[model samples]
Target: MKGAERIEIDRRYCKGCMLCQYVCKYEVFEVGQERSALDYLMPRAAKLENCRVCRLCESHCPDMALVVVAKKKGKGKE
Candidate 1:
């Protein structure tokens, strides 16, 4: 949680729907100008620092295009 983790989106399955953004309370996503493999402009993760690793966006994605990675734990603190 100290650093940001990357979020992967599969454009082939994404439908350009913003439900992931709508469901994210952290405001981690934004509507992007890039077109998807589905030939539609898809939403992008514009603010990853705001993400809480809540997995809400992954669960809310209708086509399951979103994948979130949690940061790796550092040395023996856990």
Candidate 2:
């Protein structure tokens, strides 16, 4: 799981809605004080180490504020 992709949240579009955190079975997200452009608290990737590269948050975000990027492996070892 160490080399898996990470999930990122866009603070600008976030509305303090914890749907992303709620939908994550791996508990990869948490509420943070970072205010959004809309003046609302936002959630953050607090437990990225537990993420399994699942795109549940991306598909569940109503504001389209979540992004799950698949980390690219360097070099040509594949």
TM-score of 2: 0.81
lDDT (Cα, tens digit) per residue for candidate 1, span 1-78: 543488888988989889999999889889999888979888888999888888988998889998998777789744
TM-score of each: 0.87, 0.81
lDDT of each: 0.86, 0.81
Candidate 2 regions off by >4 Å?
1-5, 74-78
Clashes of 1: 0
Per-residue lDDT tens digits for candidate 2, residues 1-76, read: 3334666678778888899899999888888878999998888788787877778888999999988887776776
Q: How many Å off is the CA of 16 in candidate 1? A: 0.8
